[model samples]
Target: MPAPVPTPAPVPRQRDTSPAEGGPGTGSLYGQASLTLLVIEDDPAGGLTVPEILDVDGHRIRLRSARNLTEATRLLTPDVNCVLLDLALPHGATGSGSGSGSSDPVDPLAALRQVLRIAPRHAVLVLTSEEDAERAAEAVRVGAQDFLFRDELDGRLLSRAIRYAVERKRADIAQYKLAESKLRAQENARLERGLLPHPLLEGSDLRFAARYRPGRSRALLGGDFYDTVRTPDGTVHAMIGDVCGHGPDEAALGVELRIAWRALTLAGLCGDDLLATLQEVLEVERPNEEIFATLCTVDIAPDGRRAGLCLAGHPAPLISRPGRPARLLPYEDSGPALGLLPRARWPRRQVELGGSWSLMLYTDGLIEGRIGKGKERLGQDGMVEMINRHLDSGLSGEGLLEASVTEARRLNGGELTDDVAVVLLSRSEA
Candidate 1:
């Protein structure tokens, strides 16, 4: 008789062989998300049968059959939750292009290894004979979730093992992601600490308090920045500035500019000359031509009674004194923001700050908060009123700033949507 032609691999089972039967609570790993099992066997009519395996929920477990590893891989879709590999299948039986050539048939765990490689993300179980118990145990060590002996296999045992394997895999993946998230958070915290400013105010009687809040969610810093330092000449220099956008790139540029300002200020640069050099730094460090920064700088005399003010398109500082309502300092001859006018001249204007006074320097974020839900914003005027109320309540120093920002957030009905930075410099006449 002519040699019998080999039967083609059963058209890879495309449909779920079991009914989608399930009730509430049917799909936990114990059977919560419906499970589908793919069995790779050499004998198309192998006696292996799971006629009925219902998960906790009344849903039946789905099954797909493949004659060899090649067909098994072709049917390994996302829906196929677990795989069952029959150890008796001949290694040479793998269909063409199955890769890894043919595993050694003598090494009983060879087929198990092949399955693990093909479906690394999916769960795998090995099936063997009672006589090959030793090899089945080795298969589990080599990546199989569990092993089953042909003689001991039954509907209930296989069903529970499949659910257990799927749940275990999920737990492993979850643990990995959590660890990755924590590592990323730690790295970001270290970077933020490095970028944040530290006041350089040794040998100075002026008390300094500053508050910073970035508008971006989960961000430690934004485009707003400020710094205060007392130079050797006893001139206390304080600055507050804001870059146009609220993002990491803008925030980084702000940090660079703040550090450069500190270095130049400590080197005896001041007034319009210092600002001109800072503008140059901004031009070179900004991410694009459209980027710009609003700045306000104050140089208080050693006596703490008077100061020189310069504005680079920034808001004016608020001055509050005993027996007087808080008000914004004059902003009559302010210059354009840095990066806007190459030859910008931030004129240093003289301001009289008698013996006892509190000067509040801030970014526009302070006055731009919304007034309730209307389209109107809590502009400079509203901010002044809010401050007067807080000051009247005897709030000063850190208490004053905290209350101010909290009230701003409250009026807006939520958190302010812009980066806010406020610096308060106070001198006591007492």
Candidate 2:
């Protein structure tokens, strides 16, 4: 009689690794939770035998088996961390292809592609015989984390490969998100640069320099806006304004007001008439009734020796002469800010801008910064003194503006918390 065949050892039952039961395994790859493996193969005769696997911390890895794509779909849950797919499985009766637009019945990797599409977030590993090394490599290129040969797979190797594949998938996702964020930031910078004004001072004798800083963190534009343009008649028009808030919506409103001011000024509207129409725009376009905007307008004559000044609840422009200290132009007749008073009137005052002089117009952000740790602010008087000091040191033009803004930030102890916009127009008798 033939010797009796030794009885095969029964497979061990998988333990529950749910979070409720003190959570999953603390394996090397798994940060906190244990790992689960879903094996997809149509092997009724048990051709493929998976050995009992353990994580790095010696915790047993739970296993689930699926006979076909239909059964695999039902078992693909959020708790399933990794998938082990057999490459030799049939494509089933439906003959579904990779979501790559066409279906091919003869394609051996069709089932693997289907598994990838259905379980995109989970890590996947393909199993093939040792002879099919080319196909295994192709599977990895097609999106699988890795591939293993059935004859070479052991408990230790499978456990390590599963952990590596999961970590790699996570790294890939993080890299993708970082690239996406950088692209979005680049697009936003381009848009903000386009929105900034391009001073139209062609055929003008004056030299113009400006500096703008937004208070909002990581923002390129804010509620402060300014524009300078030389009209058809040789008179150069310059205006600067600030909306009540420093948000995106306020920035948009400032842009609209700047464009509208440019159009109205080119059309010959000045002083009260232009400000009245702008108030109308603010009332209609503002998100609420409480929004308001302060403005300052200056129109330099063709001779560059005189200018018309208007103030709508705005700071007075500082004027500096060849041998004199900088001082603010008269602002006693200033009117209410736009959207604050219905039918408000802004008065135009004729000021003699002597030959060879510089005029600096700015929003309130520059002067409102705290002087030190105390509550006292760098008011208009302090800013005038600062400008005089810079001028005494021979700083002028762009260098002067740069030094001024830099000093303001330094005095505030850090970055200024409000948007600051400064425009400097200068002329020297030649």
Candidate 3:
């Protein structure tokens, strides 16, 4: 008998399978569904005469060969996904067809760096001898996706390594993005704390408004800062400080000192004693010898009739009573800025705030603004006139501050390059 005719079973429908969905990773590894490789070798014999590579789907691969990095660079394209670079470059690896030893010992890592610059998003595999594993590892750090020992590698192993390396590189890019986002959040938080402080006035019938803008563009906070607190005598204590530099560290130190000031003021620390303790804090936290801070403090009387002012190498507070024009308190008797003069003594001078007065405390970033088109700054007198003009404009609260800053920027014809911080304390006699 000729054998029974075989009956065919019902055919099963095939499911759609894109190369990217065939495995792990972003699917990009298998998207091309190909094993195109640029094999760089300066060896006289060319590539491993018997070329072999396991593809993305567990299949063998035939490599396209290049004698040097120059040819390899020329061959690099979107379709050529991976590179197999040989560390033992022979003569003329510089695209001259000479070889590795033909001239200078061609550094494979240097070649790898060039490859990365050209093909930043491509995956690469570096081939090295067992004794050169260290150099191979370094190649990975320099942008190669993976490094392998030439002796132990096989077709299947090479394919798996390529897939893993590609996946890892993509993961690295994602992690970097996440880290960048987190850093931005941290910076904003520090800025919020440094620029805005918790108000200490509750029952006091005083109007307090403050505005702060860092010299650093797109920055939330800077070393220039201010704060206020109500002391035990029902006196409102206000202060403004400026660190020498503009950086996150300086802003952080300023915040620390501001918070410490509030705490000490509430605890009855004032004048030289308070400044001395703050200097100690600066001494401990400042990053280096060049780091320092300038400060000014004011303690208003309970009746709003008098105020004790202290200056520490910082611009003095500008005072404007109802009948008088704005003017800076005093600076001739001021001590050196904190961190500049050890055990510095800030003199406590009595100033008449009188009834219904407005006191403006600020960092040098304010007075140091430009004057007209000249390189000359606003200085102490210029700032007083500017404030007087704003006060006469009937702008108050945040509006007053915004107007002042706008004028400064307008005078400068751009944003203030240095950090600017200001606090306004206006009181009515009891």
Model 2 scores a C-alpha lDDT of: 0.84
Instruction: Report the poorest 10 consecutive residues by lDDT, candidate 3.
Output: 1-10
Per-residue lDDT of 385-421 in model 1, one digit per residue for the tens?
Answer: 9999999999999999999999999998998899999
Residue 28 lDDT in model 3?
35
C-alpha positional error of residue 225 in candidate 1 after TM-score superposition, expressed in Å? 1.5
Q: Per-residue alpha-carbon lDDT of model 2 for 62-160, expressed as tens digits?
A: 787777776778776667778888887765622233433113456767778888888887789998888889999999999999999877777899999
- Candidate 2, after superposition: displacement of residue 337 in Å? 1.2
lDDT of 3 at 377: 94
Q: What lDDT would each prediction earn against the true structure?
A: 0.83, 0.84, 0.74
Segments in model 2 whose C-alpha atoms lie over 4 Å from true places: 1-123
TM-score of 3: 0.60
Query: Per model, how many backbone clashes are there?
Result: 8, 2, 13
Index of the highest-lDDT prediction: 2
